[model samples]
Target: MATAPAANDNARPSRLGPFLRSPAFGLVLVALLAAAPAAAVLLGQPFWLTMATRVAIFALAALSLSFILGQGGLVSFGHAAPFGIGAYAVLILADLGFTDALVAFPVAFLAGALFSGVTGTVALRTRGVYFIMITLALAQMAFFTFTSLSAYGGDDGMTLWARSTVAGQKWLKNDLTFAYLAIGLLALFLVLGNRVLASRFGRVFRGLKENESRLAALGYDAYPVRLVAYALAGGVAAVAGALLANQTEFVSPAYMAWQRSGDLIVMVVLGGLGPLHGAIVGAAVVLVVEETLSHLTEHWKIIFGPLLILIVLLRGGLIARILGGRRG
Candidate 1:
């Protein structure tokens, strides 16, 4: 007792420290990324605005993946299933003459949730490499199933004749309107995800990731928590997909390809796992790099692949370099 150290010995630093070091850095990056499209619009560059729309859509998808893969330590390679389903949901609904965003978006989200809920229940039965393989297999099943559907574009994909109407308004068809919608929805999801991470459920899920046995020993069933996170992540990814279909005015089986899932994983790792918000940063970086490098060389992957390896090998990559987080 006499040797006990003062409780204040481990007191935290001033608020300004974390703010200046990591919080502010992250905020600045987000602002710049969000503002890029607006700047492009102001400059009369509609192409860049469309590009920004892609960035925002992927940002939302990556953000959702961060929840499960980043915080919950669930390496799900089947996330693309829900994403592609969301796109198809929108397409199918529109094909049925239900083109209203208000109706279509919820249906898309529910479709994603339904797919993830079923898949997660089974996928969570295994762990490590087995989990990864199972996820990949399930996703491929979806890919082939969609490919067999000759009614729609099937393997060739389909072009949307029109964007979703918002409350019967056709503004969603406008590029600028869609861009803002994507950006605004992304920001909302990011904020919502941040809140969830701070909640008790998030804490427990993270703890399960760190030591599932320990959490289970403490009387918490890890299955439901992981399942919920998995499903929620899928639903969110689906939202991104819906926006993507709106942005591109197209839907395809390609959206569910394993390659896309791998790309999502790359974004999570590239952004670093500490705050998870870095997922958006990673998406922007990946998209921008791909856009830039593709123009410079036809074999961009030959260049991009090694760069990704380098970042993952580095100490927590860009987020660590800028934000002072521990290496992953």
Candidate 2:
């Protein structure tokens, strides 16, 4: 009888291995970095630049969710709360004369962290569908709260006339420069997320994802670990939200709506969850498809809905195993 291969031989590489070994990932990153500058110089179109930046920003948000769903096994339906809160943080601070990027970014991050900690405390206590529903409900609360802030735009939504200034510089005011800055932030978060997945804390998070009971029995307090991971994910998502407000020069309760949260989840799953880079791919695919479909027909949703269903059914798992193999 033929002996089965050793378990180690069939095992997935450590999460970091894909980043270190995959030439394709490196090439894509380099291409994206190069494209930002090329688009500015060659195209000279503000519309294209803005669209690209938006893709990057949302990609960052999706990546944040991947950390929780892909690695930590926490399906937070309220992830958009931090994202919207981050956007609101920038706008609220901008309204109060805190237009500096340095100040706005930190404030946005803090808001996300605080929101996550409070929500995670309750949601984390439950598992499966209960956790999902509680998070969705909490996000709705945030949405309603934002709508009630009349001093801000309230239901009308607020428009930012200018992007935040960096230091004493007007650098971010330039569309191309701002796009580069957004890309840089995306790169930073992607690298940091990869590092986290390689650390001891990340190991525990992944363990919990695979088997919460096993991790708990192994003497690890799964709650605190998951909570920290959730908070970190929220903070990272907030960073994306902050950049988003800067990119669009606007803020609204729509940012925190349940639909936005659902879209974030779609991006994570579409990109092939767990691998940080997959989020970027998924975002690109979704945005490109949406734009294309919208141009072809006014009721794009009629076509887009079926397309998404088809993609999900054909793709099977979150990430396409046939194309990328399993995430490290």
Q: Which candidate is the best by lDDT?
A: 1
lDDT per residue as tens, model 2, 1-328 = 1222232432355675565335358347636754965576687775677778878888889989988986676778888999999999999998999999899999899899889988999999998879989999999999999999999989978998688888968899888888888788888888888889889998998988777778788899999999999999889889899999988788999999998898888787777554677778777777877888999999999997887788765543434442243332
Best by TM-score: 1
Quote the lDDT for 151 in model 2.
90
User: Please, what are the lDDT tens digits per residue for candidate 1 over residues 85-128?
Assistant: 98998999999999999998888888898888898889998888
Off by over 4 Å in 2: 1-27, 30-34, 315-319, 322-328
Q: Where is model 2 poorest over a 10-residue stretch in terms of lDDT?
A: 1-10
Q: lDDT score of model 1?
A: 0.81
* Model 1 lDDT-worst window of ten: 1-10
- TM-scores, all candidates, are 0.91, 0.89
After superposition on all C-alphas, the RMSD of every candidate to the true structure, in Å, is 5.5, 4.9
Off by over 4 Å in 1: 1-17, 20-30, 325-328
